[model samples]
Target: MRVSAKSDYALRALIEMAGRTDGHPVSAEELGRQQNIPHGFLQSILADLRRASVVVSQRGQSGGWRMARPASDVSVADVIRAVDGPLVSVYGVRPEAVEYNDSAEVLQHVWIAARRSLRDVFENVSIQQLADGKLPAAVTSRTADEDAWQPH
Candidate 1:
């Protein structure tokens, strides 16, 4: 599963806002500068987040974007879905939505497993964990897997 640049920027933007939740609203310009996201691109991404109810925007003097809910309640999955759709997908279809025949039937299990694996990581983690520089034990263990990067 690959996170797109848009999703990366959205995560970063969310992190920035998470850190400053009670401080003040953060402008897209500031978020872009801080996260190095393209300003125009950030606007569109922010708009998506806004529509998803993940982030709320304020207009005028002390205005910008802030998390609609507490950062602790937001998951990485939420941000990813808001910006990039599903956490895991195969051939543009959800794992549960696809059917297979004969030998290809095994691929359904593979897709379900892949989606399950991704959810294991993405769902257990909340935005506040990232914002606070902490990750869940399950999440960390997956990262620490000695085989995480080596070819089988």
Candidate 2:
């Protein structure tokens, strides 16, 4: 599965926000600067997050953006979906929605299984966990294998 820069930037921005303890909204400019995300692209990403209820925006002198709910409640999968739609899609449709000929019918199962595998990691990880620099054992265990670090 390919992870887009948008998703990466969104996650980084959220992690920065999750780490804040001042109880004040973070300005987009600050988030962009800190995360090294392009301001224009980050704006669109923030807008998407707001529309998904993953975040809320405030206006005024001391206003900016903040998570709509607890960081622990927002999963990586949730953020990905908020900005990029479904976790996995083939030809712009869901894996299960695709119809294949007899010879290729089994391919649908591959796509579905891939989606499940992605969910196993993405769905289980939360922004709070990332902010705290601690990943779940289920996730960290997978990285214990030295081969996991080797490129194919």
Per-candidate local distance difference test: 0.89, 0.96
Which segments of candidate 2 are over 4 A away from where they belong? none
Measured by TM-score, how close is model 1 to the native structure?
0.93
Could you give candidate 1's per-residue lDDT for residues 1-152 as a string of tens digits?
77899989998999999987466889999999999999999999999999999999999999988989988898988889999898878778888898888979899898889888888888888888989999999888777988986866
TM-score of each: 0.93, 0.98
Clashing residue pairs in candidate 2 (N, C-alpha, C atoms within 3 angstroms): none
TM-score for candidate 2, please give it.
0.98
The lDDT of model 1 is: 0.89
Measured by lDDT, the strongest candidate is: 2
Error of model 1, residue 21, in angstroms? 5.9
